[model samples]
Target: MNNDERIHLLAKELIPLYDDLAADTRLVVEEHARTCKICNEELRRFNATFAPLAAKEEVEPNAEIKPFKKLQAFKALMVGLLFLARFLLIGLLVAAFDPAAPRLLGGNIIMFYFPLAAASLSILYFFYRKLWFWVLVLFDVFILFFLDEVIYYLLL
Candidate 1:
């Protein structure tokens, strides 16, 4: 096609004329329009035609939405509770196996595992999302098995 025909076709096919364009395609089109006056004019006209429609659809919110803040606070509370439960469960398991250990050392040991488990769970929670929830559970089981082995060796 001739340059004018090609420019017209490109203008019609441009994403800004219709829908969202891929970033790479948008860059290619924008670069071409920058160098070509006819294409630039065509794109300008396309944008001008649609700009009014886009502007008319804009709606200003009358009131700030507050429900999302409440939901976020609830999520934070649940995560805190989950960490606390994990620490307590780990402490109870360790205490059950080594009840004769001095309270000072026992408390220190439990504190160590609390941070370790919290770190592990935090990494799994952020990175894995819902797909690896069971992985955390399996990790707890593995920790329990390792503790059992340690207790058995120490007692023997």
Candidate 2:
């Protein structure tokens, strides 16, 4: 077959792969499209729709939440904004929480680790250079674990 015919055939076969696609799959689809015009045109449309999405700038919620359903969103937003604006002041926050808070009043420090882990992962994702992230994580873990062991020893 001529180049246009070959591309058309390939595109007809491969266009469905566009839904969940990647570079390797695209390359394979393109290989067949190179010899067919019809397939090439379809590939162009598929790439237009799928490529930008695969580039992944951000993740939107799958569906919109209703107003009442968004109460948690507002609570989360306030907590996130405050936590971000004054991250360094978190040590002070520990002391400032209501004394009647069961988790805090009980001296159960495990409750604190969840926020710490989230903060740690946020820093890693923002600073996505893998080596520096791993080094910082290891260093933080070492320090925290050592501090915990020391505290445990002292308490014993």
- lDDT (tens digit, per residue) of candidate 1 on 88-139: 8766655666445534344554456656666667765774477455666676
Q: Which run of 10 residues does model 1 get worst, by summed lDDT? A: 101-110
> What ranges in model 1 sit over 4 Å off?
1-67, 98-128, 131-135, 151-156
**Candidate 1: residue pairs that collide:** none
- Lowest-sum lDDT 10-residue window in model 2: 101-110
Name the candidate that leads on TM-score: 1
TM-scores for every predicted model: 0.34, 0.29
- Candidate 2 wrongly placed segments (more than 4 Å): 1-11, 22-24, 56-69, 73-156
- Candidate 2: deviation at residue 53, Å? 3.5
lDDT of 2 by residue, 4-120 (tens): 566566558769776665888777777877766767788788879877987785557686745665765765575466446444434444445453443342243344544565575
